[model samples]
Target: MKEKMLSFHDVKHIYHTVRGEVTATENLTFTVEKGEFVALIGPSGCGKSTLLSLAAGLLTPSEGEVSRRGSIGYMLQRDELFPWRTIEKNIRLPLEVQHRLDSESLERARTLAEKYGLGEFLQSYPSQLSGGMRQRAALIRTLAFDPDVLLLDEPFSALDYQTRLLVTQDVAKIIRSEGKTALLVTHDISEAISLASRVVVLTKRPARVAAEHELCFDGENDPLRRRENKQFSEWFELLWKELNA
Candidate 1:
């Protein structure tokens, strides 16, 4: 069996606003095994992003446990790259923040950039890159620190349809190639099915695990190819009903 990389055990989170208290999750339990790609999907304001925050250790659960075995990298909805910084500099931000910007780490970042087709654009600022390219750079930045797991919060939502498709494939490929486990929170069903090995559906506010489908596709595991599979539409229909339930 695969070792567990991250797990949420009967977790609950309540936001104590001045207005009152609001519970976002209740009895939420799930696990992302090492090297597994899992996507969490639900209705708007259903606490999907809150789950990512919990996994990333950015927020403490009000009850139960959120356990992680290693470090985490987060990819936000936007590229979130600094306009003034070059691609190289942006990718190096994590290391800089951690005060580990040594020559070896810098070289690792450079190698990742080159491996992902961003070598020529290392000196280029974020504004010079296309949307898809910028997202790729953002992913490389997240991977630069070699985090054991990646938390993606609708990383492709900001792109146009065309760009989103291309970048989704790119990000999926990069994550697989690097053998990194990922937990993605996306509202797009097709996007979730395309990139994840498992699709986890959550209920509305006070989110709980509604259902989970383990995906298996013949031939290539590429996101684009997965979309073309005969099973894709069937899976989509099933998930659609679950999401609406």
Candidate 2:
């Protein structure tokens, strides 16, 4: 059996406002194993982001628990790169925050940037780089802290369709190369199919696991290439049914 890296047991969440109470999630339970690539897909307002917020400890569950084994890195819909900071500087921000900013760690971040094709632009400001490059820098920043699990909340949603495809491929290759576990929440079914080892479907509002699909592709694991695989259409059809069911 796979050793679980994180577990959500009977998790439930509710929001209380002057307007009324909103039940965002109920009986939400799942397990993420070490090095697993899982994607969460659901209709809009299905509590996907709420689930990530809980995992990041940004929000407390109204019931049950969200438990994790190690550090977690969260990348939101926007790259959220600091405009004034250079690519390298932004990448080193996490290390600085943790007070672990030493020569070795900085060098590690530079090595990752270089290994992932961002070396030459290390000193470049965020405005100097293209959208895709900025997103790459953001990912390198997230990984610099060496988090055990990565929570990606539609990291490519802000980009143009073309840029989204390339960045998605770039990010997936980087994560797989680094052997890190990832949990991605996306509304794009095709995006989920291309990136996930296991795709989890959630129901509308008060989100709950509706179904889980494990995908297999014969080609290289590149996100774009995976979309061209024969299994791609099959998986897409299956998920389409599940989502609209």
Tens digits of per-residue lDDT, candidate 2, 189-243, equal 9999999988989988788889987776853678888888888899899888988
Model 2 regions more than 4 Å off: 218-220
- Worst lDDT run of 10 residues, candidate 1, spans 212-221
Per-candidate TM equals: 0.98, 0.97
Q: Would you list the clashing residue pairs of candidate 2?
A: none
Error of 1 at 68 (Å): 0.4
Q: How far is candidate 2 from the true structure (C-alpha RMSD, Å)?
A: 1.1
List per-prediction Cα lDDT, in the order shown.
0.94, 0.91
